[model samples]
Target: MRFLAFLLFIAFVLFAIFARWFFICDILNLCEEAPVEVEVAPRLQTLQLTENDSVLLSGYDQFAFSKGIDQPELNTNNEQFLDTLAQMLTADTTKSLEITGRFTPQEKDIMAGFYENMGLARAAAIRDLMASRGIDENRISLKHAITSDSLLQEPLLFAFALNDLPSEYATASYRFTNMTYSDANFPSNSAIFDPGEAFRNYADSVKVYMEAHPEKSIRIVGHTDNIDSEKYNLKLGMRRAESAKEYLENLGITSAIETESKGETEHVASNDTPEGRQENRRVNFIIE
Candidate 1:
């Protein structure tokens, strides 16, 4: 009887230990940090303008915005950086909008705070900057802003891109919304090829068109099919744009030619079929 009792006691002790260990592990996991989302405030869309076909801006250079950081203020390189930003906003005329420059993923380390708070700082700074410019709080926009390295390709929030700028305006305004300079694919751009004969004609036509009208700026947009990754599409987009730019440059209409790419992000055709993919891989030229 005593031996059976001893055996029962041992079994009970083992079960208790196992139960304690399991619960402890579960508790640890529960204590882990949850995934965080960076939320930006509603942006200002009213003040934006599109001059001609592609370029976007605020009606003037006086306005600016700050980019986002993953971890709130934790990565602040130095307290002086914040002070410098504040000073730039305050002493407007002396500094040419200290564009906190884009976040170029340099090896420079940033102190971590909270990720959400970091984004908040960026938003707050932009608002403060605009308010200082004598612009009403309602007129400023931070919705189009981003902390990524490339402004041209950030598929952020419901923000409108430079494409939303009005094409009818002779000279539109765009503010320095944010910077994403470190993104290897910067603008995640892409392009479609107008190879062979059509390519030559497109090139030649642009040359003639620009030669006839010297006062306008030409915007070359390259698009890519959804057949590949966003990064690959972006490269293809650049190639398409460069092909167009080189074509126009060769024609000697050198004054205002800008190139951009919209890899898979901006697709005109369905990605499911071969024909649609082929159609998606082309470039567009917007002239103003």
Candidate 2:
């Protein structure tokens, strides 16, 4: 009986020692396992806009409309502007016009639905004028004003710009010729490609494209969100482009590959939203 009691005491002492050691290690975080890396879901790809086609037509002093009326009458001075705009739109059949209206916040509240209706009405009026001038009505797109940073003292401030090629064309071109990938393909704040399936698939696609187009050279352009200083982002962007270029080279692509960094200069979407930021942080390939 005495030997049995001693054994039971020894067992209890060993259990107490282990429990105390485990408690100490847990308190010190020494028993914690390394965090498992979670894979990020692939973002939906969209057709990229052509860089050179974007033009801003604004800052007109003569463009104004009546308070109750949405139809904008171009003054003699503004007629020349309108003529130039119409010429540009008619110059390219693949190009389309995007019209955006601006209104003061106070005016928006005072006029209520008038603010929204006026914007669309003015856009429609512009479309009709352009159509009358021989431009295709189907090529014009109107987007209502969502928000304005400052109040426009003028009757209304409007901007007209050209859209890129149609979505069908752009999408087709992207699938066949260009490969676009986002920052999610890389580790956080790293130029190294993450060991993810999305990145590997992108690499495979690029390898196939290069094999199919031996005569064409590729330009890798990297861009980043407006999260850091321009200089820092520029360097980061270049590193990312270099990383991609290196990956391609390893894939046995012997064609010439050039890398460029635009930093935070050209943003595809507003940086205020998470999705927009994600869209901004991307690398594009231009096959020449």
Candidate 3:
């Protein structure tokens, strides 16, 4: 019995030794196995997103529906819409757009505390644009930028996505003929001036929206589209900017409005193409 017990103890020692060796070998293998690439967190490459890429289309309901106007029928005799776009394009554009603070019922539409205000503000802007296009001055129209969640979830049931409606007209259906921003050759100015003159009902709408807010102030700047000398562009930019300013001033808003010109320096678009050049020659507003 003692001999058997001694033999068992010897076997236990060998087993223990083999177990230690196995664990040591495993530890060594783990260290050699590609070092587990302690992955440093990947650096984030930042990029900018602008208004053009946004998919939220809420603004104009009638215009988004079958009744939505892509472009107004050119007033053949007056060409009011084209002329309006032109004036808007020529207006100074150094300033970024501004919207006045508003009295709110306390809901936002974007990333909280801003989404509703922003959406309502945009809708108000569309209303102002329609007004610029000749709505009855005494009557004010109101609509919600929001729709029933059911409308969004079951678009077929609601028959339309409210955002699909345009705010004034389809931006896709523009009616202007000449959109160049050069002093080398200017097109004949229309006999009568359109308040917007070019693609600027948007700007005017913003101005009008600010004015509607009553407590807020607004300012605007203009710039050229790089079709001429910077000096000439600046001066030209001022004329159109002042023109817009004066128009707003005449709307019984004398003091809170300001205007200036920035020539061709602060362009939001490239001046390489006719389309882009048209975009660059413009005006914008700042609000407080």
Top candidate (TM-score): 2
- lDDT values of the candidates? 0.45, 0.62, 0.40
RMSD of each: 18.9, 22.7, 22.9
Error of 3 at 188 (Å): 6.1
Minimal lDDT window, size 10, model 1: 172-181
Full candidate order by lDDT, most accurate first: 2, 1, 3
Runs of candidate 2 with Cα error greater than 4 angstroms are 1-161, 164-173, 195-199
- Give lDDT for model 3: 0.40
Kindly give the number of clashing pairs for every candidate.
Answer: 29, 0, 27
Per-candidate TM equals 0.32, 0.42, 0.34
Candidate 1 residue-wise lDDT at 260? 88
Comparing 2 and 3 on lDDT, the stronger one: 2
lDDT (C-alpha) at residue 221 in model 1? 69
lDDT of 2 by residue, 1-288 (tens): 999999999999999999888887877656667899997433222212222454345444445654445677566656665676678767766566655544545444332221223454565576667778888766665544534534233433333334643331121012224545667677878988553454465567667877888888989888888998999999989999998889888878888999999888877667888867776787877778
**lDDT per residue, candidate 1, 1-288, as tens digits?**
999999999999999998887787676554456789898544323332232354333322122233334322221322333344445435543222211222323312331121112332343355454465553433333322224444312222211223234332111112221111111122334232323432344445556766777886777666676776889878877787786677567667675978888777765446788745554555566666
**Which candidate number has the best lDDT?**
2
Q: What does the lDDT read for residue 288 in candidate 3?
A: 54
